[model samples]
Target: MTKPESAEQDHGYDVVISGASLAGSAAAILLARRGVRVALLERRSDPDAYKVLCTHSITANAYPVLDELGLIPAVEKTGAPHNDARWHTRWGWIEPKAAPRGPELPHAYNIRRSTLDPMIRSLAARTPGVDLLLGHQVTGLVREAGRTVGVRASAPQGEREIRAGLVVGADGKDSAVAKYAGVPTQRHENTRFGYLAHFRNLPLDGGIGQTWFLEPDMAYAFPNDDGVTVLAVLPDKKHLPAFREDLEGSFLSFIRALPEAPPIDGAERISKIIGTVDYPLISREPTAPGVALIGDAALTSDPLWGVGCGWALQSAQWLAEAVAPAATGRGDLDRSLALYARTHRRRLRGHQFLAVDYAKARPFNPGERLMFSAAARDASMARHMHLFASRLIGPMRFLSPVALAKATAVNIRHRGTAASARPRTHSEP
Candidate 1:
């Protein structure tokens, strides 16, 4: 990548991005590739700084974007597990026995955040026109006429003001940039606490992602890189004591209690049991004036689905594609922001709605039970369920009128079979 000449301290670049996570870095690379000078800021000074010990699964739905970014080869080169998913539904394990139908049915990547974050950040830094500003912490928004115009950041050498046509909050759920800009957001409480640790050598679940939807308690085993698997258990608030009293014991017991528990009973632990209890479901307006938000800064619901990584990259792609013309001075910035927001809502709202509803720790509703059971019993139904989980389709589309009709028929047939299977009872006189 060629070195970029520094622009004036005032209005320095085409875009000023707040965080250097997936969304931020992705936006930087995409924009800079189109001759948009970008200032990508990271609070941590180290170029290798990565999101630690958190979710790092990116579904196959985002593979096209990854390929577009020229990241697929590098990511594959890392030897990250190419994992298939199996969902434990009420009826049974809903596993797709058929091979992937096409190139679209790609295997998802399960790499550690420690590796992924740095890799992506490095990719952005190496882009031609991106000024990767490490250790720059955004202190306040620079607003003009009630519109975000720039950001005031604090760095090792004191403070500096950088301006741009757009400022993006790619920061995490508790977004400092969004907060400083006073972006209005709808917040939902998470009724469950999550705990996890990395284990090595679980032969039964080798290179396969297994998620159990046990109502009120959920478990995930993500086969990750370097022969490691990250095991997570999310339990309702009422079940917090089991984790508090004995972390390992409770985690193991919960896994053992799972109907389709893997032979991870004696897997070797490779990391400490870390957890998060106060993770919230947040949804904010995606744009504010000259500022736009992406990834968790815009929306973060239940982590149980592992959609965060995909959304981060996806929303960045949406924003960059929508705003590229604006960055190049060909389109209206506000209109572009509006388009991005509309696209974001249209693409994500259905999934967010269902995720928020499930985050409340409630039992599965009739529709959910119907879908899960049908998906378990029928291969055709399982394919749709698999697609939905892979982020290839949204909830509303997955549960169409035809789907409901099929689910009803499946349930009726199962009921009939059960009734027939019941033995005849003879009453003695």
Candidate 2:
């Protein structure tokens, strides 16, 4: 911890946020809307830039936040559409037939980060109190009296300091602010690597997102903007050798092998195949002194779950709500930061645990099989499962004792029915 006292403390903004992408921009928008000063720093120079290596499936849980930001209509205007999600389990596809979640709950958004990022940055940069400092790379934390006051950033002009009451790290998984703040993180080993490619003219349900959990291998297909469908696969490392041999060939082969494979025959690859193998599940305590972390900076889970974009927006909302009064000078800022930290942990701990558990790339256990089977049999179970996956409901609600018992009984009944149908040999008698 490098705590140094500065001779001339420069308090420029209420909050200096690193990374002007999803989380940082969203936080800036929130605070700026409330007339709190914000400095949004981004390393990228391009105003239209987006995160290229992402599947970009925004979960339903972030819909409310989008609405609050007044950006949902903008996203829709950009051809990004609402999505209905279905999960493929061992028994069958756990497809919920319910209408899309209301404004109070999370809902799905199928938009590329290319469109989403610029839209988000535009909103933040245009906010009255936000200063969008593009092409700025955060180098170190500005410390005063043993608390992080802001950041030392290098921009196109030169290196300079930006001071604030609080500094936020929304800088993705390998967060420089988190590193500078000496924030503690727990890394979990991930057994699977992810690959995603966009295809044009793919024949599929227009606004439906589908995921197949074939044990150690999982694949998802979502129809996104501009008549393109994104197909992604998470295969265990054991299968990487074959994929490395032929990137495009192997990706197509793997997806084609799924039980009810996507109808992508004769589809054109619109983008280069994007992939990542080093995505370890990362969970960090989201605050340090005067600094707070949001998005992947705070907690990065399995990519197979497609929760990053949603979590980024949702966490930003949580932080903004938690610290608004303090940042506006109505309450103690440190106590407000602590409040944000506690709220972040409470909201994400259970989700992170389950995501990390699945990141091990292991096949479903008996309990999981029971739940999946029950979800396949019961619409209510399927709806609950979908709500949990979308992050509209927490783990405690999704994994209650009643749900577990129902799943167990459903599985037992399925077993009994199968056993009754089996032919018996007289030799045993």
Candidate 3:
């Protein structure tokens, strides 16, 4: 470990966060708001730089965090629509109708990362007590007596040592801080690969999102800001050879072949189709002495569910909430770190487990088949599924005895009339 005093300049703060992306920026902003000085570091030179290969769906479970950060209005100003998703299942469509009156139902948001990332980064930069260090790439960590003391960042001018009471690794799944700190990570293989591209003039109803659960394969159409629709396909590895032979042709054919497929032929392609064959599920123990990890740095779930963005924001909030009092000189930092770790696991571990299992691209289990088929036949069943898929409820509650019993009864009731009750194909009105 390098001595902190050897650097040309040593900056001190309550927290030094690596990577000024969603997790880093949100952590910095929330920590700074609680009277903690923060140094937000980003390797990217451009302030407007955004992640390109992302579905960019923020789940409804994180709306409270966005509201607390005073970002909802700004988010709306970007023309991001509240996304209500409809799923295509083997039984038929599970499209729940919205309640006509009373309190509004929860919904997720669909905004391209190109518009969302810069907006949040700028917000954090403008926040008081947050020193946004652009182009400062974290290269090493400063440790003393087995505790991470700070980070060594390489900047345009020279190497600078930043000392802080707590070091945060909000960088990404491939986190330098986690790597340098020797955090243990568990990797799970994803049997399905993904490909996506943006299009214009897509006539999906009310810009709502659509997902097709084709057993081992999946596809999605997310209508986003500025009249853009992102069409994506996640196919099992068995199709890899065909996709590798002709990327665009394979992607287009896959989407066009979906039951009640979207109007791909009618829409104009706006961006190059991006494909990624490998993105293993990653889960890391999120805390060490004087250190805490957030966002993809801590856990990278299957992209098939589009949980990364919301989890990034939610994890940042959890960390800041856990450590803010300690950083403000009012509590024990170690205890706070422990609390954050516990809370993180309690909230996300089950979800991550399910996501990793499904990432293998296996056929749905018996429970899934029962629940999905029942959902297609019953409105209440569909609503329950909507809540679960929107992430408003956890797997525990979603798979509870009550829900399963309800689903079983629904299936029994529809046994004879199920075919007649099935939703019309997407080609219908």
Which numbered prediction scores highest in TM-score against the true structure?
3
TM-score of each: 0.94, 0.93, 0.94
User: Model-by-model lDDT, in order?
Assistant: 0.84, 0.83, 0.87
Question: Which number leads on lDDT?
Answer: 3
| Superposed Cα deviation of residue 256, candidate 2 (Å) | 1.1
Model 2 misses residue 55 by how many Å? 2.0
RMSD of 3: 4.3
- Candidate 2 on 1-429: residue-level lDDT in tens? 011222123446889888988998999999888778888888887778788887778988898899999987788887776667778876788887764563332466889888889888988877888878778889998898999987998877778898888899999999999999998879999999989999987776435788999997899998887777899999989999888999989998998888778776778888888898778999898988898999999999888888899999999999999887788789998888888888888888999998888888899876677678888877777777888888887889888999898877776776666669886442110
Q: Candidate 2 local accuracy as lDDT?
A: 0.83
Compute the lDDT for candidate 1.
Answer: 0.84
The lDDT ranking, best first, is 3, 1, 2
Which segments of model 2 are wrong by more than 4 Å? 1-11, 99-106, 205-207, 415-429
Give lDDT tens digits, candidate 3, residues 229-306: 889999999999999999989999998899988888988999999979999999999899989999999999988898
- Clash number for each model: 0, 5, 0
Decide which is better by TM-score, 1 or 2: 1
**Which ten-residue region of model 2 has the weakest summed lDDT?**
1-10
Q: Could you tell me the lDDT of residue 65 within candidate 2?
A: 90
